[model samples]
Target: MGESVAWVAVDWGTSNVRAWGVSADGGIVASARSEAGMARLTPEAYPAALDLLLTDMAIPAGAPLEVLICGMAGARQGWREAPYLEVPAELGGLALSAVEPLGTRPGLSARIQPGVCHKGVGSEDVMRGEETQLLGLSRLLPGFSGLAVLPGTHCKWAELDGRRLTRFGSAMTGEVFEALAQHTVLRHSLAGDVVESEREAGFDDGVEAALARPERLLSSLFRVRTGALLSGKSPSWCRGFLSGLLIGTEIAGFRNWGGDEEVPLIGSTALCALYGRGLAAIGRKSRIVDATDCTLAGLRAARELL
Candidate 1:
């Protein structure tokens, strides 16, 4: 089969961008990834950046090539503000709320998918690209209804009621770990990364401890330094313990808000594995789903709606 035909799917984020030339039958024909994400581009430069990324794709010259974009590209400060659709939002109907950005050349027809939001009585929360992944999960599983744990700098736990997002919450577990490891006194005690290879390096112990007493998290965090200063703990062990403590705390907190026993874990494989470990320690299990697969599938679902 020659490289040619129909539309595109672009997942644009703060640090990187990925574009896929999709065929009519929902297969990817050509793809490209670049560092020209929302952080690097000005409003007027979006069209040019997209054009540059699609340079090698064999889209025929004539009618404008359709491009569906998601993520930070739809942020208020992005190319054009694709307003947030308030939850309970319909995953299948996301395409109906797309917005078009300005300065598009005649050769391209681009639209941005709006993010999802939740407005409580006083506090409010929002999500950008993850909604597509939720839609993809729904599409991929046909009728999946459970708690989805999307691990990231800001971990999101979303409740999917069939194809609609009923409610969700975020936990700054990763960010908190970073801050504790880098800015706090724990810096001297912990390793630069989380537990990756070893098994019994203090991770499970920390998880169990935190699960039992999440209310003592602030004090528990400081104990990392004390463990190194007094008992001569290894930095690697301290890191694993700290990682597990934070993740386990996150899981414990989610339990308060509510969660399912069999959770759908999304995003980075390594991070999800860490979360899976924490969940397992608390009698819950998780199935990891690659974020890329969900993104592509979601774009297809949106394209179908369009």
Candidate 2:
């Protein structure tokens, strides 16, 4: 795609940075990525990171390029603090809440998109990259109303009513799985990466068990260890079972907390597939939306507001 770059969109997360060169109509014409995510950069070091991804674009001459970013780059500990937009907020105007950083490269205007916060809901919860993806769904399909799940290290379940993110919740499914599989007795039994027949069966079994008794999650967790020791379960099965148990428990908890409409899972393909499987296990349904598509649409949406 040798099209001239009219603007740039970026999703700057904790571990990496991605950029897309777009035409005036917001169609992505070029793309690149860098390892210099927020966790590796200080305020002054941000420009070089941007430089890594914004180079050699067919930028229009004598015109300043526009750059819109979302994700951890806006966190308090990120490149620059872009603050959080309090909940009950409409998704369309996220860019209005964004903040301009002081030291972008020459001929570039940059703003970091703000995250959303829910202070007085059931508990205090906040999100960064996930919000842009949510906004993208509304952009990709206007007047879209329903529940959406953005799954990752901390999976977010957000509610959309009348185009506003009315309320949402987060689940630490990935982190918990990491801890339980590496630090506990379960680690010894979850050392394999193969997902053959035994693994798939274990996964389904774990999901069913969680949905059947969401209340007994704690006790069910230990079953991995016992099954491995006495029942002669394979390490692959333990991995699948532990993964299913955590993801299934999360789905069950969400169902208990009013997750009734069709959920469009916004994230990577493989992760969303796993969530889709878990949902199908409990008689629920979901659709997958690639995170790249969401980020681009979201950044474009934010750019239009500017």
Candidate 3:
């Protein structure tokens, strides 16, 4: 690679696209982002969106670009699908090379990283892009072992043995919350916003209810609505109650299936706080790490092998 060639990092998920230009030492020299996410574009439009981003970011044509992308953009429906490397493989084993257009430019090169998958005991789960974050976490928290939770639309509970991803599970907590708040009968019982104090108060209650009977999760969710309408609880508090219930249930279910006690949460600050409060309510402690940094750190780690 030429000394002046610019290395690029991308974290393209279902809802967002982010890119950064990095120096040899991995310092971000420039960055850009957009909403042209995987869900919004057809296969043919993928190259167009990338072109626009590069143009908007003023990445000059003819400048050699080495790109590493993570997230859903590597899924079957996204740019291209990357195959999962089974457990016991090093992070480097996750690498896959595929060419993508550089905007409208010809002869440009781009590469997408594959997600990870696990199957066992009649259950299986997969994660796109988050595996990169897990690798980043491994580097950031050297010698760290046990479970790391990446919470978002699809929550990822990853088991790490050193730098390797041993196993993982996914929870659709965020999506479920969105559907309940917008489309379900429970919508009437929740407020426009979730109050932190109320979430704190009901955090443990939610976790407890979830762990009490795993099969009764649906019925327990209905109780949140009933508690609001019949018992005269504030709609806002009810929202918090519902939040606690779902998150708690996730925590409880994972714990039942062997989630580690001391977990590292990787996500936004707000989600991390919510998770922290829920864990506290359940008498568990956790460490919080920034998902964005993890994304960049992961891309940087992957670039080292290029």
Candidate 4:
């Protein structure tokens, strides 16, 4: 059996759901993951899906379990919508205004934390899961103040003034890469994954190309095919080049948001490492934070508010 639970923490996203059983002092007791994410379930199906996740956990029967959740589960189309908290707002207040859905399990007291939104002059963006990571950022770097980036399907760049999330922006880097690689003519050149040994060289070339002429991105992508067909470039190299080109452009675009030569990147090791390399390309460095640890810490931090 797992360690006796104090509360449960969940990060439910579009494609997967991860839950952790936590001790009172913020230690993890148990953890589980499932493919039953928001995209696969209706509003009425969330509790059952969540129940299936918890079926094997070690929790006392008939005792209330405080389940704190973050991510797409709180989106407008998820189980129940938790309206976003506007930016320039305090991250600590996330749990205070959390929404509790009616008809959850008899012994489950579930609260879904709201996402953050930035409605500034010409910049409008919203984030769900990343806000929790930002909340956990406080514990990782106390009194931290600078730029923080989370790379994923839609990469986010957020600025923190001490503990408050000031302003943020999103880049559709991963999504765009998927579209270009799978649905467009660029597919021919990107048919295979980048070989580990070849990635660095191809990626560096793409970064340099994009940095030199960011405006010519559309035309440059065409070269991926032409280079493969004419110059006989390999599919692996072409894939790496395309990835680097997209990510490099994203970094170049967001560098002015005060990267300050060092940024905090929190996400999967693979993605964060890629972003770290991209940051290095632009003469900036980054610190990586494991997404799971941040989510647990953020959930614990939020629970304290109750």
**Superposing all C-alpha atoms, what RMSD in Å does each candidate have to the true structure?**
2.1, 2.1, 2.8, 1.6
The digit string of per-residue lDDT tens for model 2 on 65-137 reads 8788899989888888988888887767888888998777677788888999988846999999888888788
Error of 2 at 263 (Å): 1.6
lDDT of 1 at 232: 79
Clashes of each: 0, 0, 2, 0
**RMSD after Cα superposition, model 4:** 1.6
TM-score of 1: 0.93
Model 3 lDDT tens row, 1-306 = 234337778889898899887877777877789999999987678777876777666777666666778877777788776666665446655554433433434645778887777656577778888888988887788888888888899999888876788778899999999998899998888756666676555555666677677568889888878887688766667777778888888887777433545778999888888888777765678989988888888777776754
Which ten residues in a row are the worst by lDDT in model 4?
A: 53-62
What is candidate 1's local distance difference test score? 0.85
Model 1 spans with C-alpha error above 4 angstroms: 1-3, 56-63, 191-200, 256-261
Tell me which of candidates 2 and 4 scores higher on TM-score: 4
Q: Tell me how many residue pairs clash in candidate 4.
A: 0
- Give the C-alpha miss distance for residue 242 in model 2, angstroms: 0.3
Clashing pairs in 1: none
Q: Which residue ranges in model 4 land beyond 4 Å of their true spot?
A: 192-194, 259-261
lDDT (Cα, tens digit) per residue for candidate 4, span 105-187? 78889999999998776878899988888888877778888898999999999898766999889999999999998999889
| Residue-level error in angstroms, candidate 2, position 179 | 2.2
TM-score list, all predictions = 0.93, 0.93, 0.90, 0.95
